[model samples]
Target: MSLPTVRTVADLRAQVAAWRGQGLRVALVPTMGALHDGHLTLVRRGRALADKVVASVFVNPTQFGPSEDFARYPRDEGGDAAKLASAGCDLLFAPDVSVMYPDGFATSIDVGPVTRRWEGAFRPGHFNGVATVVTKLLLQGLPDVALFGEKDYQQLQTIRRLVRDLDIPVSIEGVPTVREADGLALSSRNAYLTAEQRAVAASLNRVLRDVVERVRAEPGTVADAVAAGERALLAAGFDAVDYLAVVDVASLEPLERLDGPARVVCTARLGKTRLLDNFPV
Candidate 1:
C-alpha cells in the first residue's frame, strides 16, 4: 500500500516518526516542485535506500533574488503531487510559504568562504537561502538518508559541506545527473527555454564535456581549457557567459594550473534564465 502524504512541520514529522518507531529507515528527496526524471531518480534512490520516502516540493522564494524569476517560477501542486505519488514517493510535503516562514523565521545557515565562491558570488545570498531551507527540511523530515542529484553538483557540494560542518545526522547521497538524449542537464528552467534556445541549452553540457575532453587529451593548462569552454558557449548561442572555471574537484578552489581531480564548472544566462553545469576532469 502507498503511504499518505502530510503537510506542515508538525503533521509531517508525526507521520515519519511513527514509521521510524516501527524500525523503518526513511530517505528524502528535496525538490522545488518540478517532478522531472532527474527528480524521480532522486526519489527512486531514496526508495531503494530506505523503506519510506519524503519528497519536499517548495520553490523557495528566499533563494531567488529580487531580479530573478521568483514570481514566475511555475508551480503545479496538483500535478506535482500526482507525479510524486506515481513515482512511488511515500510522502509529499508541499509546504505553503506562509507556513514555512510564518512571521519571524530569520535564522539562516551560512557557509562563509565556501558559499562565497562560484554560484554564491554570482548570485548573492542564494546559498544562504538554500542552506537555511535544506536545514529546515532535514530537521523536519529527519530521514536516515537524503538524495541530491549531481546535476547541481556545486549545490551538492555545498549541502555535503554544510552537513559535515553542522553535524547534521542525515547521510547525503549524490546520484548521477539524468540528462536529455542530446546531453542537456535536466532542469525546471528548461521550461523557460524557447524551441530555438532548447536546441542550444544542451550546449552548456556540451561545452563542459569538450573542456573535460581537452583537458584529458591535449593536456593544456587548466586556464587555457576553461577559456576554450567559455569560447565554446559564445559560439553555441549563449547570450552571456557568467563563469567557466576549472577548480579542484575535492576542494572546489579555482585551479590556476593543470592539476589533479579538477572539475570544469560553468554558469551562463540564456534569455532570462540562468543555467549551471559542471563535469569532472
Candidate 2:
C-alpha cells in the first residue's frame, strides 16, 4: 500500500495512466477528508472491485456557500493518508486549493433539471460544484467505477444522470446509507452537533422511516404522510425544517402517491448541523 502524494492534475493522470496501461483496473473514492467508517467502507468496496484504488480527499471550497462552514469543514491529511493506506488505497490525490483551481477558472458542470430540486434548490451552486469537481476527478482519475454513498440520495442520482447524459465513460455505483445504532444516517456534518442536538437529530431519520411504514401499512397520499412526519419531527425539538419529500428514485421527481418504490427524504437543522437522510419505500 503506497501513499504517493499527487499535487497536480497532470501528475495524477500520469500515475493513473501508467497503472491503467498495465492492464490494472483503477477505482476512485472521492471524499472531503475527515475519514470515518462510512468513508472507509467506500474505500473497502473500491478495493474489492479494482486492482488499484485511488482515494481523493479534497475539500472543495466552491461547494460551500458563503455562510456555510467551508473554513471549518474538518480536514486531516496525515490521518486521511494513514486511513487510506491501511484500507489498501494505492494513491491519495490530496491537492491544495490552488492546485485544483488555478487562476482564471471559469468552467462549471451544471446538470440542470434534476439538479434544480431538493438539495440543489436549498443549496444553490452546491451541486454545480459537485458536478464540476466530480467531472474533473473522473477525467483525472479515470476509474472504471466511482462509488458514492446513498446518504446523499439526491446527489447520488444527480451523479448518475450527469454521467449518463454527458456520456462520461465511468460507471456509478451507490453504497447504502450507513446508520448509527439508533438509525441516524452517518454524515460528515454530524460532527458539528452538540450531544443534545445529536439526540434531537435522530427525529429526521425516524420520521422518514415512519412515513414509509405509515404509507405502506396505513395507505395515504404523499402530502398527508409528509405533513404527519413533519409534525412529529418539529415536535421533537428540531431547530428549522428544510423539506420532507417522497420522490421517484430513478428521476428524483416528487411523487404524489406511494404506489411502489420511492425515497422518503428530509433535511433540517439541529442547532448548526444540517442533517439529510432518506429511506427506500
Candidate 3:
C-alpha cells in the first residue's frame, strides 16, 4: 500500500489521533530523505516495536552548516515514501521549511556538552538544529517510541539526553549501523563518491576497526592508536582527517584509557564528501 503523506502539523496530528483512538502503539522514524538501507532499517525496527510507524522526510536547513552541503543535500521524497511503506511505515511527515519553522519561529533547543565535541566541534550549531527538530518531531507525533540509527552515534546519544532532560514521554530506540559490502557505512552522502573515492571510502571503517583492535590489545595506547588511524586515512587517499577518537560512550569525553565502555569514532574527507563511522572499543 502507498504510504499516506502529511505536510501540515494539523493533518499529522489528526492521523496520529486516529491511530490513538484505535488504541494502537505508534513509533516514529525521522529522516532527511535520500533514503537508504540505513533509513529503512530504522523503519523496520519501528514496525517491530509498534503497531504504526511515522517517518518524517525534511532536509532540515538548520542542521547543515554554512559551508556544508545544504543545497546539495540529496532528497527523493517519492522514493523515500515508497521505501518507508515497503518497510511497513504507515505515514510520512514531509514538511517544508516554512511549515516547520513558520514565520517568526525564534526558539531552539540547546543540548550542551554531549554535542560539544567531534561532529559538534567541527559543525557548529549542527546538534542544536538536530535537537530542535527532534524535539518537534517527538512532540508533534507523540509516539510511544522513536527510532534512530546508531551510525550517527553521537546524534543518538544527544537525542536520548534531550528526551530525558525534557521528559518528552517517548521511548528512544537506536538501530545499529547498516553498511555496504565493502565495509563502508551506508549513508545518503555516499552518492557523491566517484568510483575511486568510493573505493577509498572503505578505509574510514578499516582505520576505525584497526584502532578498536589496537585499543583492545594495548589499552594504554589510545593516543597512538588514534594518531595511527589518522595517518592511515591520509595514506589511503583521504583528503583530510577531522578526528579519530576513543571516547567514553555515555559522556562522549575523550578517554586516555578504556577503563569502561568507549567507542572509536572518526570522520574524514573523501573528495567533497565527509564520512563518519565508529566501532565499539
Which one wins by lDDT: 1 or 2? Answer: 2
Greater-lDDT candidate between 1 and 3? 3
Q: Model 1: how far is 185 from its true place, Å?
A: 0.5
Task: Give per-residue CA lDDT, model 2, range 1-281, as digits (tens).
Answer: 44888878888899889988999998899999998778888888998888888889899998888999999998889998998898888889988888779899989988888888888888999999999999988987889999899989888988999999889999888998878888898888898988999889877888888899877775557888999888888899988779988888877888888777788888987877789999998
Q: What TM-score against the true fold does each predicted structure earn?
A: 0.96, 0.96, 0.98
Model 3 per-residue lDDT tens digits across residues 28-47: 99999999999999999998
lDDT (CA) per prediction? 0.86, 0.87, 0.93
Question: Which candidate, 1 or 3, would have the higher TM-score against the true structure?
Answer: 3
lDDT of 1 by residue, 1-281 (tens): 34466778999999899999999999999999867899988988888999998999999998988898888998887888888788789888888999789997879888767677888888899999999999999998889999998878778888999999999999999998889999988898899999999988988988898888877876556778888788889899999898888887756788776557878888898888888788878
Poorest 10 consecutive residues by lDDT, candidate 3: 74-83
Q: Candidate 1, residue 131: CA error in Å? A: 0.3
Error of 3 at 46 (Å): 0.5
